[model samples]
Structures are given as C-alpha cells and as structure tokens.
Target: MTTIEAPRSRPTRRRGVNWEKWGWLYMRFSGILLVVLIFGHLLVNLFLGDGVSAIDFAFVAGKLADPFWIVWDTLLLWLALIHGANGMRTLTNDYARGKLRVVLLVLLAGATVVLLVLGTLVLTTFDPCIGDSTVDALIEACAAQ
Candidate 1:
C-alpha cells in the first residue's frame, strides 16, 4: 500500500497577505468567542427570569432597544455568518472540482454578504416604536422613548 502524503502549504504571492492562514486563525478564534456569546445569549433569554415563556416581540424589542444588546447581536450576526461561510468555502474547495467549485464559492460569498448586510441593517435600524401594537409592553416601550 502507498503511504498517504501530508498536506502542503501552497505558495503565496510576494508581499501579499496570506489569507488562508488568516482564515484558519479566524475559524479557531471566532469559534471560541461564538461559544461564549451563544451561551450567554441562551442563558439570558431561555433560562433566566421567566425563561422561554418570556420571549416574545416585546422581549425582543426590549433587548434591541439597548445599545449593548445591539452591539452584541451585531457581533454575533457577523461572526457567525462569516464563520459558516468560510467553512462552506473550505468544504467546497476540498470536495468540488473545476467550474462547480467556482460557482459554489461565488454563490456562497454572495449569500453571506447579502445576509450580513440584511442582518446588520435590521439590528441597527430596528424601531420598536413603529406600528400600532396594543400590547402593553410595546406601548410602554414606545412611550418611554
């Protein structure tokens, strides 16, 4: 039987950034950060206070109103999407060939960018005070603004 060879590092462009290395590093670092952010989010939203029953539009509105939560959510959105996209790209590279790989990579990148833009817009521009909601929670939240 032939011995399997180890993976080799590809040659890089002179004076250019080694993006593959950076991507690998990002995967590791972002994974650790995501665990913390995700767990914290779950604990606050699902376990504390009234638990799962407490989640609703009003609860979401309240969280989004705070700048801290807005930033927290933005980070979660960007990091998670990019991390997932990067992994997909890596998988596409490893498993796909020729035109299919190119097509998949392009599609993956386009989708990731679109989602990131939309998610960020929603998070940053969300107005809980909009619309006519009779819920006391929403009404009270709007009134305080």
Candidate 2:
C-alpha cells in the first residue's frame, strides 16, 4: 500500500496594524453617510421651494454663505471624494498590474487632493457679489451689505 501525506499549511503572522480591516470599515461607514448626505442634497436642491429653477449662482452663494451649509458641503465633498478614490484604488488593485496600478493610484490620490482643496476653497471663500454688476440680484444682495 502507498503511504498518504497531508499538505502542510504556511504559518500566519500577526501584524501590528490591520489596514485592510480599517479600510473595509471605512467603506461601510462612508457609504452610509454618503447615502444620507446625497439624498438630503438632492431633496434640498430639487424639491424644496422653487425647485430646480431656484438653483442659480445666487442660490449657491446664499447656501455657501451660511456656516451650517458650508460645513455640510465640506463634509459631503470630502467624504464623497475619499469614498470614490478608495473605491477606485480597490478596483485598480484588483485589475491593474505592476507600474500601471501604481501610476493609477498615485494619479487618483493627486486628483482627489486637488479637487478637495479646490472645492473647499470655493465653498468657504465664495462671494456672491464678486466683480459682477450685471446681475441686479447680486448687486442688491451686495448693496444690502
């Protein structure tokens, strides 16, 4: 009779930090938050008051002028961008190979950072009455100030 042997398994090592675990948690939490934020945003922009027609420059300016809206917008922007970028990173890891994967990840990170910074700046420093004398509404709004 021939002797039978069992395959040996490699030993597993415990790491100090579990980044993948944290990333998985982040995806779950961020997805939940994004759903609420996005729905609230759409409801406010498309269902409240005058609806879509009310969504013009002054409307945006008015919203951004409020501290509450500013914070809300910033949170939405950061969360959405990071969530999207992380998702893309996961996809890249799964399908991309070698240098191309690295390049795509680096570019993704760079773009996310740039967009977050620019978006935050626009939200925080927006002036409804900047250099525009054509719009009577803006002129009136600025004149009141």
Candidate 3:
C-alpha cells in the first residue's frame, strides 16, 4: 500500500484591529445598556402614571412629540437590534456551512442595516399629524402651544 502524505499548510499572522474582539466587547457593552434601557422603558411605559390603561394612541403621540424620548428610543432601537443581529450572526456561523454560511451572514447584515435605517428614519421624521384619523388630535396638541 502506498503511504499517504499530509498536505502542507501555510501560517500567516494577522495584524491591525481585532474586529471579533471588538464585536465581543460591543456585545457585552450593548447588553448592559440594553438592560437599563429596556427596564426603564418598561417601567415608564407600563408601570408609571396610569399604567397600562394610560397607553393609547394619544399617549404615544405625546411621548414622541418630545425630543428626549425620541433620542432614548432611537438609541434603544439601534443597540438592541445590533446586539440581536450580532448574536444571531454568531449562531449562524456556528451552524451554517460553506456558501450557505456566507449567504446567511450577508442577509443578516443587510437586514440589520435596513432595519436600522428604517427605524431611525421613522423615529426622526415621525409626523404625528400624518393621517386623517389622528390628525385632529395631533393638531389640537400642537395648537395648544
């Protein structure tokens, strides 16, 4: 029987920013921030004032009217979505194979970016007086100023 020979392998050291390490750091950082933001959100929206009974269309309109809440929510959206997407990327890498792995990663990244853009636009450009049904309410609220 002929002897089998192992294939030769080459070793090359990588340099510069360790993105995976940064990604890991980001996950931990974002996770901590998410806990604060999420809990604060739940506390304010679900437990404060009139509680769940106070949550209505007008309540949302009123909150979004303020710039502070808008910024808070925007950050929350960005951090949570990125954290979740990255976590899912880790999972996909663990389970997927070859071309399928690359495809999944691309799709995940694309979806995350699209969602972030859309969500940010919605938050920043939100016009409470857009539709007819709630236009009156928003107008009245604005006019009250």
Give the lDDT ranking, best first: 1, 3, 2
Tens digits of per-residue lDDT, candidate 2, 1-145, equal 5555566755455778888788889889999998999899999999999899889777887787788888888889998999898899999999999899999999999999999999999887877778766668779878999
Clash pairs (backbone) in predicted model 3: none
Looking at candidate 1, what is the lDDT of residue 25? 100
Ranking 1 against 3 by lDDT, winner: 1
* Residues 39-135, model 1: lDDT tens digits: 9899999999999999988889889979999999999998899999999998998999999999999999999999999999999899888888768
Between the candidate structures 2 and 3, which one is better when assessed by lDDT? 3
Residue 129, candidate 3: alpha-carbon lDDT? 67
**Candidate 2: which stretches are off by over 4 Å?**
1-14
Score every model by TM-score.
0.83, 0.83, 0.80
TM-score, cand. 2 vs. native: 0.83
Model 3, 3-108: lDDT tens per residue?
5556675544479888898999999999999999999999989999998999977788789989999999999999999999999999998999889999999999
Query: Which candidate achieves the best TM-score against the true structure?
Result: 2
Show where candidate 3 strays beyond 4 Å.
Answer: 1-13, 49-54, 142-145
Model 2, C-alpha of 6: deviation from truth (Å): 11
For this target, which candidate reaches the highest lDDT against the unseen true structure?
1
RMSD of each: 4.1, 5.7, 5.4
On a 0 to 1 TM-score scale, where does candidate 1 land against the true structure?
0.83
Alpha-carbon runs more than 4 Å astray in model 1: 1-14, 140-145
